[model samples]
Target chain A: MSFDITAVVNIMGLAAVAVFAISGALDAARQKMDILGFMLIGTATGIGGGTLRDVLLGNVPVFWIREPVWILICLVASAVTYFIAPKLASRSRTLIWMDAVGLALFAVVGTEIALEFGTSSLIAICMGVMTATFGGIARDVLCGSNLTLMNEELYITTALAGSVVYLLLNSFNLPNSYDLIGGFLVAFILRALAIQFHLKLPNPHRKD
Target chain B: MSFDITAVVNIMGLAAVAVFAISGALDAARQKMDILGFMLIGTATGIGGGTLRDVLLGNVPVFWIREPVWILICLVASAVTYFIAPKLASRSRTLIWMDAVGLALFAVVGTEIALEFGTSSLIAICMGVMTATFGGIARDVLCGSNLTLMNEELYITTALAGSVVYLLLNSFNLPNSYDLIGGFLVAFILRALAIQFHLKLPNPHRKD
Candidate 1:
C-alpha cells in the first residue's frame, strides 16, 4: 500500500533472483553454453517475470532498469553458480527448495505491484502467476527442455493461490506483515507438499 | 516526425505482422504444436517487437491493446498459414521475401518510435534492431532452435543498418516519405542479397 511494503518486497526479491539465476546457469552449463549464454539465460530467468509484469502494468523502464542493482545481482549470482554447479550437482534439492521460496515471494510481490497500479483483482492475480512462473518457463524454452513437461505441473496454480491469499488477507485490512508472511507460507507449503508427494495435475489427453 | 509518417508506418506494419505470423505458424506446425501454440507463437512474433518498444518508450497498453485489429490480423494470418502450409511447402521462398519487407519496415518503424520518445540516435538504432529481430528470436526460443546459430547470421546487422540509415535521413530533414522508403529499401536489399547468396557472417569459431 505504501513505500514500507514496497521496501519489504524489494528485500525479499533478492532471494528470488539468486535461485532463479542459479537455475538458469545450471541449465546453460548442461547445454555447454559459454559465459555469454550463462549470463543471458540467468538474467532472463531472474528478471523475465518482473519485466513482463511491469510492462503489462504499464510501469516504464521496469524495476531492474530503474535501479540496475537487480541486474548486477543476477549476473553475479549466475556467474558464481556456473562455477559451483558441478560441486552442487549432488545437492540439487537445496536449489529446488530455494526456487520454491522465490516462487512464493514473487507471487505476492507481483500482485502487490499490480494492485498498487490500480488494476482489478483478476489482472493482479494473473500478474502474480506470470511473475512467479514466467522465469522458469523462459528458462525451459531457452534450454529446449521438454516443452510440455509443465503442462501438468501445479506450479502456476501455487502462485495463483499465493497471490489470492495475500489479497484476501489484505482486504481484511490486516497488517502488511501478516498478509505477506501468511501468503508466503501458503505458497511455500503447497509447493513443498506438491514436490514431496510428486503431485501432478491429471491429463486425460496424455497418451501415457 | 509527424502523423503522416506514423500513418505510413502503421500501414506497412500490418504486412510485417502477417509475414511474421505465418512464419510463427509454420514453425509451430513443424513442432507439432496445437492451435494454441500456433496462436501463441504467431501473436508473439507479430507484436513482440512493438510491444517491447512501447514498454521501453513508456507507451502503455501498447499499440495492439489500443487497436486490437492487429492482434486479429496476426491470429487470422497464423490460422490461414496453419491450413495452407502443406500446400505452400515448396514455395516457401515467397514467404522469405515477405519476411524481408517486414524486417525493413519494422526497422524504420522502431527507429521512428524511439525518436518520437526523445531517445538518442544510438538508442533509436538499438530499438530498430530489437523491433526487427526480437519476434523471430522469440519464435526461435519457443521452438527450441539453436540460439547461437543466429550469431553467424547478418540478420540483426541488417536491422541496425536500416535503422541508422533512417535516422541519418531524418536528421537531414528530408521528406519523411524519402527516409521511410529509403530505409525500407536499404534493409530489404541487404537482406535479399544475404538470402540469395547464402551470405553469412564469418564464424571465427567454426571448426570447418
Candidate 2:
C-alpha cells in the first residue's frame, strides 16, 4: 500500500508538537510552576528542536515565525494539559508511549529536513538526534534536572537508528513512502521495546 | 594612560575562561553531578559562546581548537572549583561578582573576535552579546533552571554596550589599546552599576 510521505510528515510533526508540549506542561505542573512557567516550558518543548534545527540550517524566519499555528498549538496544548492534569496524571504510561511515537516521527522529519538542506548524511543524522532530544533537554533544564545530559536512557540511540535508516534508504534510492514508514516503525518499535524491557546503556562508572 | 587593546583583550579572555569554568564546576557540584558532568559544563560554559561565534562566521576548528591553552585552563579551573566548592559556596556574593567580571570580559573579547572575522558591526554586537550570555544559558540549562530566557537581568544589554563601544572606537581609528580598555571598562562598570543599583529594564507587559 502506498503512503503519502508529506501528509505523514505533517501529521507527525503536529502530533510530536502536541506530545512534547503536553510533556512540558506536565513537568511544570509537577514542579508547581506558575502559568507563565507552564506556557514557557510548553512552547519551548514544542518548538525548541525545530528552532535549533532551522537556526543551524540557516533557515531564515524560523519555523514558528513562518507559521503561527505552531505557537497556537502549543498554547492550546499547554492550557488543556494544565487544566486536565489531575485526570491525565493517571495516564502517565499512555503519555510516555505517545512521547516515544513523537520522538520517532521527529527523528525522521528532522533528518529529512537536514537532507533537503544539503547537509552531509552524518550531519543530517546529528540534526535529527538534536531535533528529537533538544526539547526534552530544554524542559529538563527548566525543571531543574541535570538528567538531560546524564540520563543513560536509550532516547538518543533511537533517534540515531531512525536517522541511519533514513540515510540508508535514501542512498539506495528507495521510495520515499517506504523510507518514512520503515524509519518510523523502526524507531517506534525500538523505543517501545527499550522502555518495556527497561533497556538502558551501561554507565562505565555506575556506583552500586 | 594609553591602553593596549591586544594585551587587555588577552588578559580578559583568560579571566573569562577561568570564571566561566569555575562557575560551571560550582553548578555541577550544586547538582551533585559526577566529574564528567563537571567537565562538560566547564568546557561548555568556557567555550560555548566563542564556538558559536566562530561557527556563525564560518571559521573552522573554532577558537578553542586553535588554542589548546583554553582547554587546559578550563580543565584546571573546573578541577580547582570542584575541590573548593564548599568554601566557595560560603562566599556566594564574591563568586557572583567574579562571574560578572567574566561576563564583561567575554563580551569584549567576543566583539573583537567578531570584528576580526569581518562580520558586520551589527552581527559583531550580536555575537558579543551571544558570547557573554550563551554560556550562562548553557549553564542554566544544565543546572535545570528556566531562567535562561526569562531573566530580566542586564546581561545582554551590558554586552551590547561593550560591543558598540568597541566598534565605535575602532571606526574612529583609535589605537587597539584604547578600544580594548574602553570597551572592557564600559561593560564591566555598567554591569557592576546595574547590579549595585538593582537596575533593570522596565517590563512592558506588566500584569494589570
Best TM-score goes to which candidate?
2
For A27-93, candidate 2 gives per-residue lDDT tens digits of 8999998777788998899888888777656665788899988888988898888888888889989
**Chain A vs. true chain A, TM-score per candidate?**
0.92, 0.94
Give the residue spans of candidate 2 off by over 4 A. Answer: A34-37, B1-47, B51-109, B116-133, B144-208
Please, what are the lDDT tens digits per residue for candidate 1 over residues B1-208? 4468667777778988989898888888899887878889888988888888778767777889999998999999888877777875677888888888898899988898888877777667757877887788788887878663254236766787799889989999987788888888898899889888877654332334
Q: Model 2, A58: alpha-carbon shift in Å? A: 2.1
Against the reference, the lDDT scores of all candidates come to 0.81, 0.78
Tens digit of lDDT per residue, candidate 2, span B57-111? Answer: 7664455545557766887788677667788778878877887888777787788
Candidate 1, residue A66: how far the Cα is off, in Å: 2.8
Given the true complex, what DockQ would model 1 score? 0.18
lDDT of 1 by residue, A20-83 (tens): 8888888877776655456668877998899888876768767765556777788788877766
RMSD of each: 6.9, 8.2
